[model samples]
Target chain A: MSIQIIKQGMADSIQDNGRYGYQHLGINPNGVMDPIAATAANLLVGNDLNDAVLEMHFPASVILFKQQSLIAICGADLLAMINDVFVPVNTPIIIEKNCVLHFKKPLSGARTYLAVKGGFDLQPWLGSYSTNTKAVAGGFEGRNLKKHDEIRFRAAVQKYDAVLNGKDCEILQWKASVKNFYAAGNILRITTGSEYDWLNEDAKKLLLSSSFTISNQSDRMGYRMKGDNLAIENKQQLISTAVTKGTLQLLPDGQFIILMADHQTTGGYPKIAHVISADIPTLAQLNAGEKIQFNIIGQQEAEGILFDQQQQLQQLQNACSFPLLKFKQQYAIN
Target chain B: MKSPLPYHILPLGDHALTIELGNSIDASVNQNCIAVFHQLKQAGLAFVKDIIPAYASVTVVYDVTAIRKEKPSAYLFMKEKLEILLAGMDLDQPVSHRKIEIPVCYDLSLGIDLQEMSQEKNMSIEEIIQMHTNKSYRVFMIGFLPGFAYMGSVDEKIITARRIQPRTNVAAGSVGIAGEQTGIYPLDSPGGWNIIGQTPLKLFDAKRENPVLLEAGDMVSFTAIDINEFHIIKGSI
Candidate 1:
């Protein structure tokens, strides 16, 4: 069974958990910018959270279903319409064959993810299907989806019974999309980076006190901003060194680069601070001109919070295992 | 040499620590990085993920949750281990030399910035090539690009600054000089280095078990080759 693309979005590509362990080779592990939402959508459809899915940017839609299918629309609210009926986010819906699935546009966030049972059948590239627009590798032909690109599907043990049973229209129970839980604008706490000491006292204060808006310059690689131009006390060339995802780099030109999912393996810029790992998902959802404040935090406190967040993910994994764990339990009961 | 004041093993992120051996950047700091690297790995610090040796500073990645559970002062644990390791290490470690023949074609058509680099260095194009190839260099680090080794301590005479304008794309294995340091591009990437020659060998290949030809702290020397020899090596690879 397969789904065909009718209306290609502004930018759409397949992405999974991302490729790792190759940073020493200078390769940036590019993947879904909003991993949390992507995983949520996959879980709703009872698919592996790391399974490949179509990541669509603002403004797009597609047609799906060969022998009926179950899918979930996630990430941005995006005013998604299912067969002329506007549907809510964070829920599973059974789609019929030849249904004209339309995602009118993203109103709140930048990108959205669509997950199907058994996952989209996109062949992996270099062990990942993530789209790295800069390196021009990975994803579909290592680029964005074009007009009328035909996407297929993989067969699996559990074809959503709701779809296989040939239900005309069925929507799953509702749970609020995670976005609804957060305050519109909250202070982002970050651990002071090694370069924090290098920043002039005035610049350091500005970093703490000032509000910065996510500029249109934001992309998968880095997020640019217009704010109180943070400065460094010492303006010497820093020899290139290894950096990682979430490294908040301050450029010599008095700008900040919030490293994202597709950030380079290493960098020479003096890193100002790192956005706490738990907040990275929220940071990814931010769209152009979304204003947010930065608050300095202690490393120990942040690590404690991060551990709690990890434990929560482990719980999520345990919870999602109903897709397979259900069968094991039934067999034991029999 | 005087023992380091003491390194503050502070957490960097969820999985890393910035062990500050000295506040100032110096050769001693780099040596300390090398020393800590040896000690941490020798101790079979499985929780210690990776160590990135920087200019005067080294950041070691580890599971913060694990470290916190252990409640070991990163300073006490690391410093204690380093003191023992440094005490045993000899400053005059035997340095091995390898004559790695890189087939480089010094043609301007392929090198792109050959003429512009020579003009900046205030030397004949031929003179620049000779000075660059004649010097043996120490591999300081492997970064910037895969298999791209940062070899340095070049002869001061040909120490030209990096181009103010970075080229959008420098082909893989391009030999370029940035200031006193020379490096090879293992992958096609944008760079600010002044390109003087192009190497024909494949510096990186994912298929190989050890994809990189050079690593940090290795010794390297490049030998010039004719365009015909370059094509032969290039095609054979």
Candidate 2:
């Protein structure tokens, strides 16, 4: 029920819900920025919400355990393989002990998450298992996994006779499709910033309607974007304060600064619009030069969408037919 | 455009509001930002999660779902609320702010830009030190890096621009000047600020409950200290 690193691939690291409560201390909350994909894979394997998983940047390779276990891969259409054969994403696959699981470089996007049945058991620091490479704290020695790193799992697994006995290879019905939630290069929804009045009506219209490209100067800290020039009522210095993920910092150079998962705690740029919280995951998948437009939606609508997303996740949890796992033990609550 | 002080009240995800304090750069507006920002911090709204104040504006992170349940028109409601907040902003008001006294050593060893700045300002090393420590500066805002406090207007005589080439790492608590602004480096990081002196007081501590000691609208004063006091404070921390 465990795996070890033989070849660490590119940039594989340990990630969970990210380290919170430390942002005030100048630490970035580094974690799996794509919650939907990570959580979906976790739920499929019956793991806790905050369980640590292996986050592979682009692609990676691993050696399987001595015991058989369930595993799921989610996010990014990175060409993946189990041993030498191609493996599909979003479905639970059982791998025999001592098998090699390898993933190829991203055919399209970056970041692929791999979750195991019993979850990866690594000690957390400051209440989180997420890694911050810049701060050199938490997760895999405050760094990414390297070759010859021995990884281990904590809990013993009580095997569930794979449900859907009628099903054969790749139980597509048992999983939910998160790919449907996104449309490549679509307009991201935005809400007006406090500085909108500073911009003329034409500039506001441009901000709402024009297309913006993610600039080359980007990283986990922020996405420097090139788009319509937003005119401020006046130009001057900005004092610093707490800026979080999804924060849009309008720089003096007339470019938009969209804060990301690993952004600094504070900023001086005037934010013109905030990338809606629900849309942040969408932003996470974006690469440099990918163009996107803004679609303004009401705050209530945004919240309703978030609430609905959470509700859907809860629904998946409740509808899980655990009792049906073993017909003989079906009626037993324990 | 009018007395209402036109600006935008934008949304930041489910828990933030980006509030533009004024249309442009004005010292009066910056002071207003400090004032209203302090008031809102005291008011404490449930929808609001965090408020970020910048040079000429402020951003308020809030949960919009909590703010509006009825699905009201965002354009009308947000604009109206923004106007009311700005209209009510009164300058002749008082609010409590935190005060921090920093101990500095302006010795030549740690300050890389000292000699050049001294020559430019046409003053001796001691004259520059006295001029910098003479005034109590306000923390206008915090940005760039963690614990980095952007402060202002130190006698104009010693005012200087950023270094032509940024240093790879500026020691923590190092006090510097960049283009008429004085600030303290909260963490050791690569910076372009003109190095003038170094402070022993910790600007940021991850182990502490409140990581950053300084906030917007707070007052800071530099008090020169001997190496003995510097060593004591360092050991105590």
The DockQ leader among the candidates is 1
- Candidate 1: residue pairs that collide: none
Q: Write the per-residue lDDT of candidate 1 for residues A226-324, one digit (tens) a residue.
A: 788887878877766667667789887898888888776667888888887667777887888888788777776677766665555556656655543
What is the per-residue lDDT of model 2 for residues A1-334, given as tens digits with 9 covering 90 to 100? 4687888667678889777544433455678877777777787666786788777765475655555566788877687776676777777666656667777667755567888877777777777888766555567776888887766776685443343242222333355567645544667877665455666677778887889899989776788889878777756555554567777788776778888877876765776777776677777777788888888776667666665666666676555434124432652312
TM-score of each candidate structure, all chains considered together: 0.84, 0.77
The 0-to-1 C-alpha lDDT of every candidate, in the order given, reads 0.70, 0.69
Candidate achieving the largest lDDT: 1
TM-score, cand. 1: 0.84
lDDT of 2 by residue, B154-179 (tens): 88788787888899988887889987
For candidate 1, the TM-score of chain A alone versus the native chain A is 0.88
